[model samples]
Target: ITVEEGLEEEEITLPPLLIQPYVENAVIHGLAKKAGGGTVAVHFQRDNGALAVTVRDNGLGFRQEEGQAPSIRHSSVGMTITQKRLELLGSA
Candidate 1:
């Protein structure tokens, strides 16, 4: 995890909580789909007035057409929850 400091004077804003789960899912479940190990990159930066966090994995990515089942351990909760959480944040 990467952390930035020197923000006490600035406001403390947080990304949607569901996004947290999305990140975890990407690292855990996404990598499991791959045969061997892969790298998971997480980028944290300030964009305009908001914080931007990007989670990327080199593992096998998902394709919607597959309609594959969600991992029993991980579920598809990350995607579903993250999307809804982002929507709520937009309204706020």
Candidate 2:
């Protein structure tokens, strides 16, 4: 896991578990599937007036079924809850 903070000295606070699921998925589904393992890179930066968080992994990606929601396709309950929370916070 590599975290890159582009904000320099700026400090930021995120809602708990907001990005945890993505990292969990990356490890459980991405790196765990590969024979040699892979890296997960998480980037945090200021994009315009908002905070940008990106989680990336170099592992085999999954295929989604037709008309399936991403959270459902990935079977990520935490992600689904996080999406709902974001929607409620008017950030989605």
Candidate 3:
């Protein structure tokens, strides 16, 4: 895994949990199943006092063939929880 932080790190404010779930998903759900190992990249930048974070990976992405079912392990609840956390942080 790699992390890239932009120059604006000291000037921006961010929630503690903002970047964890994405990075976890990138590893646990995105890259772990690939035949060969892959890389996970976490990027953070500050834009106008806001912190921008990204987690990316080169891995076996979600793909299902015809008559195939989607993976049961994938769920949208993590993202939903993250969104709610952000909303709560914003309102605080």
Q: Rate the local accuracy (lDDT) of all candidates.
A: 0.64, 0.74, 0.66
Clashing pairs in 3: none
Q: Positional deviation of 79 in candidate 3, in angstroms?
A: 2.3
Clashes of each: 0, 0, 0
Per-residue accuracy of model 2 over 26-56 as CA lDDT, tens digit each: 8887777688999999887777767678998
Candidate order (lDDT): 2, 3, 1
Per-prediction CA RMSD (Å): 4.5, 3.9, 4.4
TM-score, cand. 2: 0.75
For residues 8-88, what per-residue lDDT tens digits would candidate 3 score against the true structure?
A: 445546667767887777777777777787888877665565566678888767655522123634345776688888887
lDDT, model 1, position 77: 61
Question: Which window of 10 residues has the lowest lDDT sum in candidate 2?
Answer: 66-75
| RMSD in Å for model 3 | 4.4
- In candidate 3, position 11 carries an lDDT of 53
Pairs in clash, predicted candidate 2: none
Candidate number of the best lDDT: 2
* lDDT at 20, model 3: 80
Which residue runs does candidate 2 get wrong by more than 4 Å?
1-10, 64-74
Candidate 1 vs 2: which has more lDDT: 2
